[model samples]
Target: MATGESRARSIGQQATGRTVLKTHPGSKTAVLVALAALVTGCGGSASDTAPTKPSAGHRAGSGSGSDGSSAGTVGFDTVFKTEERFQQALPDPASMAGWTPRNASALIEDDPEPAARCAPSRDWECAKIAHGEANFEAFGEEADFDITAFVDKAGAGEACRKEATWSAKYTKAPGAAVSDVESHAYYRNVGGENGLYVTMCLGTVVAEVTLAGPNSSLDPDTAHSLARQFVPRIQKAAAAS
Candidate 1:
């Protein structure tokens, strides 16, 4: 009886060991799949949290800045138009008094075109005189004169002279020397606002005249009528320049 029992126990133990060996490979594969799932879950969550970049079109409107506040549209055309209108308001040389007739050869001399008939001295020249509508440009020379300072000297007076304003001097060519010759004067009919008289030193002469209507008290209707007639001609002359 004891021998039979021992043999049965040995058979049971051997069967149990064989079953464990057969299932070992499948258990390892299951554990590996679970580990792979855990790693995939962590990776997918990180990807979802990443920040997105803006589209190219959106970035362009934001200008060239990290904070998106530096870009805008510029109105270059409007600025240019304003400048053109100001230029058009300037006076013309042919309409001024003391100016000679249009003569290309006369300009070759050291004398200014209007001064051709007058004596030529250092900074001393003559200007032609013309009146109508009161928009004209007179040409002459000045010696040792500060035009800007002169205009400032005039201050807000109705008729005074000290220095010339930028509006008066900007039209001339560079290196065109001015002299002080009190022999010349700048006159503007002003069309009733009141007239203006600008007198400079002897070597200084009147170069241009831009009338804004007579003095302030003049008739507005008459001034407007004159402006309408004169502004067109002045504009045409400036355009030729």
Candidate 2:
């Protein structure tokens, strides 16, 4: 459960349009990345479009609840088999090349309130059983990296699409990717900093890669490539589960 102050901050963020990330004993880049998904955190409206017909990489079922809101779920266990598996799924320093990981290890969250407040809407705040994230800082560059994966309940393709569409609407981003998988890329300014937020869904797993920094050399294309690179990794991990 969240403390009163934490809950208050959550409400404040939604009500006042002011984003505040509670201090974590993690790296600075992690804190900054939390702001990247603030506006579209967990809760989504009923108006966004939901994909009909089961898409590849998503389980078949109805798109959303008859109420036209995000469909609820009973949730899942670790999306990855374990915390170690979740960490192993993230891109390493060698894979990232120019970026050096800042956090001592991936930050894993099983708590609902904070992640529900910090992640993108389709990332499914409350439905996630485990959320793992890591931060990296570019060598001799202003860029930073924040990537996350979620263990969410399966069968919410339409709800997830609805949430993603809602977030894209606010970011003025293009629609979801037209591929065998369900994915999206959004480039925009959040909390006054420029960022590219790319996300994908494979079964019960949701993955997001965000590149953000003030005066950062990173661009939308870089984030897009990273998301693409992560796809197979996430698929393998989800398969193991």
Candidate 3:
């Protein structure tokens, strides 16, 4: 939801190779939008450019028994049936030990302009139809993880894949293998603190999770372990829908 001069300034700073300041705790959507703009806008510099093609990070079925879960594809009508159902499918920090969570309002990109802003592109390859996100902070440390589930039109997983790939490249993070789904992982260093970002696509849902903090012991293994639990819930929700 960050627009006007502030949004422009965010993108400009990223383009010019400046350290992107950590946004406030409440602006998760704005942070995601700024990240999308960073990948699309910073195509000139070698370090800023993303791969034109997706990496073979991990290949598996769309929650169809690969990860020992039977969640499969559902129609758009089912997945987008209601906003509450979508929100209910998101990751719950209560399930994770010692983590406190706050959720943002679910976003539905029903209009063209907002959809365009979701993933800036002439062809709109990375736009999402709807998304729900939450931020979770550790009980007594400067560490946290943010998880978001994005739903796209039926059979449009490729768009979600593009967004994940661009994000990984922008951070110069390496790909990691996640079981039972198509996924990518990247290592991130924000303000000299280490973090991990992992994304997986299941059916029409793209689940993104980021873990960061200097004091936190979270790593790729922890993130992937959480995805193994959280991704299946999303898949089950879609199948039920």
Candidate 4:
């Protein structure tokens, strides 16, 4: 849970609209209007989108790796799977200890509060933590890596598009050469179960991890690491969830 002061600070930052992605002019109006309608129809105020209930039977997949290492399960809600090679490619955590969350909550809060927009999953509990938004999805499923930890660096084209508006910033992991730094982007599947969307970062050394669920908050790097540590444990929990 976040302290009152922390939450207040977060709210203040949000109110100032500092990190809101600058959308293209032609589409910006439409997007904002559509988002407004979504909030209104969901019985959520313009500012609050947290849901009141939990989703049921969120099926996840669980499996073991060829080497007998635990390959985590994927739930029905799971959108994409990370390849083993990709997980192995991540840089050592020791090299990234200094790569702490940099205003990570800003990244997570890019979207509206989910608690009002969608229900929490039965396997998980939704809460707003200090680091960011978090969804305590009970892992009944298992996988080799936490699918969420992987960050997506925007592609060249996307990066170029973004560059037209704002300068792109790249942070290289300690000891990682400039060439090793890569860009990725957030991906979400649309058209299913209210269409799940995820906003996260991907780096050469960092793996992708789920930042938030439908009605949860995102956690910072430390929290993300803690969650990653439980990748194997959560595989079981997700299977059970």
Candidate 5:
């Protein structure tokens, strides 16, 4: 959980209209406004207009994430499989880690919408990310990635639009790609959940792992460290078929 002092400092900063990330905030401010009126993390993402969807990057053709991709296909079951994969992808509170890693309370499917929005009257208005179509294949139904991780798809030219479209300052985590059509992996605080969210985007395929404590934990530093440690492993597992 966030230390009382730390929470006070964060509240002070936000009250002044200043953000936790100032220099490298993405293109827009992202706030994960949920069913409650909560202002979460803020970061930058891609532009407003939807970019052209790229080819399916995950192992859709092979029918499993561990089985390297062959034919052009995309789906969650193949990308996210074992519960261990999901567990290892985030911090483990059961092991005395800062937060408990579990399947997201809700899963977001891939959509080609330009932006994430909410009705002002819904008490849930925030700068959420929205994305467009992809050039990949779906795992028809037997897929299990959906069983493990929450997925979100977005297109921003030749980049991991889903990762780029977040409201946090993203430092390059280890093993993240360095290319035009590359994946951008990162993590940041999610205030509403009182934790941090780790996002790994391999083009159209995105895995969202939240590390939050039941006790209102807000450990951004731990979140980043955990993300740096786990994202690479997840990527490797995704590649190892």
Candidate 6:
């Protein structure tokens, strides 16, 4: 595990915020409501009723269901027992119609630290969802590093700067065994690119999601909505192991 300052710097560079737009009840059409309620990371619900294939804007999930048909796989599925299932969590451009992959490898899935990265002993399983526009990743491993500290330090402003030219954007909610499992979100923009990052520490897993847009100013309401949608999915991924 990385030590105090080292850990802070490592996670600080890695983890980070929320402002969002709200949907008005005055909206008439479902399409209008969905358009109003934006999300950076796209996927279906965790329930059994959720779609097996990736949703409209999402580009994750793989393989066929029990009925010999391709199922839309998005988010954390309890059926992920093998490495194939884990690998299937990765996004494929050709898998979806009218989908174009510009820069898929821009978001990395490996540990940030150079020396103390995930080794064989650490036994880490990482799944990343990245596109030219956004980045999303999930990490599952033995209790090797202190992820709780990462979350706490991140929120305390000891890790990464809450106000990275954007603002102090965070999302938290009650009702969880682990206090930090609630959620933490922040945003930053470098050059003409704007990115929104949200991190969650659950069990021995740390799930991170991000949105990178070409514009300098991103929609806070969209980031908030994405964070809210993704936090539970991260929790489910952590519990799958």
TM per candidate comes to 0.16, 0.53, 0.55, 0.19, 0.30, 0.32
> What ranking of all candidate models by TM-score puts the best one first?
3, 2, 6, 5, 4, 1
Q: In model 3, which range of ten residues has the least summed lDDT?
A: 4-13
Per-residue accuracy of model 5 over 53-105 as CA lDDT, tens digit each: 22354121221122121322232233442333333332222221111111121
Model 3, stretches more than 4 Å misplaced?
A: 1-70, 73-78, 112-126, 139-155, 168-176, 190-193
User: Model 6 TM-score?
Assistant: 0.32
lDDT, candidates in the order shown? 0.21, 0.43, 0.45, 0.24, 0.28, 0.28
Residue 43 of model 6: what lDDT?
Answer: 31
lDDT of each residue in 114-141, candidate 3, tens digit only: 3445444323233444555545445322
Give me the runs in candidate 6 sitting further than 4 Å from their true place. 1-180
User: Between the candidate structures 2 and 4, which one is better when assessed by TM-score?
Assistant: 2
**Clash counts for all predictions:** 35, 0, 0, 55, 19, 13
Residue-wise C-alpha lDDT for candidate 1, range 1-241, written one tens digit per residue: 0001000011111212332211122122111011111112222332222222324432211111121121111111111111222222222222222221111100111111232343332222222111111121112211110111111111212111323442244232222121222212233343433332333321111223222322222222322222232323332422433
> In model 4, which range of ten residues has the least summed lDDT?
29-38
Top candidate, metric TM-score: 3
Model 6 lDDT tens row, 141-160: 00011122122222222222
Please write out the lDDT profile of model 4 over residues 1-241, one tens digit for every residue: 1111211112112233443333443222111111111112223243333222222321221111122224443222221122222223222222122221111111121222233332323211122211212122222211112223211222212322332223123221212111111323232333431111212222211223333335322223323333334333323322332
Candidate 2 worst ten-residue window by lDDT: 3-12
Off by over 4 Å in 5: 1-159, 166-193
**Root-mean-square deviation (CA) per prediction:** 43.1, 16.0, 14.5, 19.2, 19.0, 18.3
Native RMSD of candidate 2 (Å) = 16.0
